[model samples]
Target: MLFERLRTLPLRLLFSGSVALFPVSTWADTAAKVAPDIDLKEVAPVPRPEAKAPATADQEPSPDADEANPVPGEPEAEPAPEFVKTTRFSLLGSDVLPGTSTRLAWTPGIQIAGLSQPTPVLVVNGLHAGPTLCLTGAVHGDELNGIEIIRRTLYDLDPEKLSGRVVGIPIVNLPGFQEASRYLPDRRDLNRHFPGNPDGSLAERIAYSLFENIIRHCDMLVDIHTGSLKRTNLPQLRADMTNPEVAQFTRGFDRMAVVHSTGSDGMLRVAATRAGITTVTLEAGESHRIQEHQIEAGVNSLTSLMEKQDMISRMFEWGDPEPVYYESSWIRANHGGILFSEVDLGARVNKGEILGYVADPITNAQFPIHASADGRIIGMAVDQVVMAGFAAYHIGTEAEVPGE
Candidate 1:
């Protein structure tokens, strides 16, 4: 019932920074241009203050008295500037000072027979103030690629040189993760419940707790995921370009294929956007396993995104930007048979190009699936036994990224 609490939360939850992004006319144009991978910038450590020599016994140690205790008449030293851009900020009920990082626990209210596990939240509060970017992975327990991406991105950061905060939740659904399943113990999809109902079901309650405690703290969010049901997707951004705010932030990613999607009801991206958080879903590789190439690609894009946000400065290679797909459709099997792919992921095809084929095992009947439009394959199922109308291939029609 308290789902709309984002608007009512303390104003401290709203963060600001000196570097605000300009409107993105095109997704590809949003990043700094590059051909071959090369480092152009570097992260510098914070300069330490010089240590003063020890004073002799005769020479009285003179510390700055005025700095320690100001006179009562002298205007109360401006009380930390009331939730301003920089200074020590409080999060998760503690003051998080600049140039520091900490681990916090997110414990659910209920503790019934090992069902509730307190998840660890990694926070890196930087030396300077900027937008807060949150990276979440494994909303689905079977998804392993994202878990590694979050770990590598957060661990590689140096808090002393960071400009903004990076909050990483490596795994959100612990119940599902522990069981190696995609849903909760009760078979509820955790990703489908967001900005959840406090008095609702188990999934809803957990969703509400996370959203209220951690999710709202972000200025921007990228929910990491992998293709479900044995499907694999190219590293891409799924965003609702319809929102002007959403379009502006999607420009931060490097070389990710942008797919326009508003997201389904109760999804984290949709709820966060409704609550005034700029959000998008990042999908890479397939579920239930980790691929090195996919993980590297994901990590690169994420770091590139951070640099574009000015959160951290570092030298890194930027790949050529991929195209934006305005429309996409899944090519399904027409007959019950074993499926085999003829084209690889990211392969371009003509309207009538054959993508894959389905063959009936008992009877010698083979059916080929063709592209309905001139586009590239963005997602597809792994070769396996299939029934009639199983989604076999997904193709996306390329289009120019929309301007502001």
Candidate 2:
């Protein structure tokens, strides 16, 4: 019975692990935007360092022996290149050298019309040794903002100066992306099949392939996403704040709202966290369209993360920190009709304040939708027709929600 209940839940509800189902609607015309092609221009070839000349044995030794041996007050000699701890990062059977970048592809066993498709991976291995940070986007194919965010972030990075490595998968669902659909050709949601089985369904095999090959190598993870169809979300980070490590990860994204959500089953964040990897999900804008503001914010947040990790030297001033919301609730529409929103995203609201109204077009009657609790609007439905019981406004409240 539990399995049945979970199986019947809508894909949007899967984010919050809510069992209730609502009518799922999307803008069909907005789905055809192609995933942006990676620009090779950003990755320039690194010039080799000049080799130092070795002293000849015939040369006379220095007159001052104290000059050769460092005194107590003198600075110590730097470690030789060979002595430096340099790690050769290997992924998908390819070895990526320090101060360079490479692309790795993963192909599942299943083929569409007998043609196998490969997922593109971008890896930048820095010269200095440090942690491995993984950046993934477009887990749900229709979510395009994350795809752009990953691309922009990767483009701005320089492996020659970076202390750690950054691995990026710009588009995780090629088939769904190609079809402009949220699910695979089999109509299965790929986000719900993490750490998947090799012998299970097609989505499971694909998930297993990703987990074993790519995800397992990460020390830290930031999975980017956007709101579901017909819904728009404010830029925020969702993480399990109870865990010290998770809380630290949340703090890395400067000046961004942090929402505490101990992600649901089969989610990449949850699975990665179980594997002892610090993980967080970045939700911004909405699906099917690329919003420039959201994309820029996502890029800046990632830059902030790298700065926090001491992976790079560039310091970004992110003004004033945002609060971490522990409790949140969705205000459902009480009447079905054409909806108009009075409040904007991220607007503060008090208890019983009117957020929007549902109007009967035929009768010209309007029903005011009031907030159940005092909070800020973290997410809301775009101005459109809505049905009764539809989640219209997602408010981040001051009260802590149970089990969160």
lDDT of each: 0.75, 0.76
Candidate 1 error regions (>4 Å): 1-86, 113-115
Error of 2 at 269 (Å): 0.8
As a TM-score, model 2 comes out at 0.78
The alpha-carbon root-mean-square deviation between model 1 and the true structure, to one decimal in Å, is 16.5
User: Native-vs-model 2 lDDT?
Assistant: 0.76
Question: What tens digits encode model 1's per-residue C-alpha lDDT throughout 104-139?
Answer: 456545345234345656677777878899889988
Clashing pairs in 2: none
Model 1 per-residue lDDT at 252: 77
Winning model by lDDT = 2
Where is model 1 poorest over a 10-residue stretch in terms of lDDT? Answer: 31-40
Candidate 2 residues lying further than 4 Å off, grouped into runs, are 1-39, 42-86, 112-114, 398-404
* lDDT of model 2 at position 4: 93
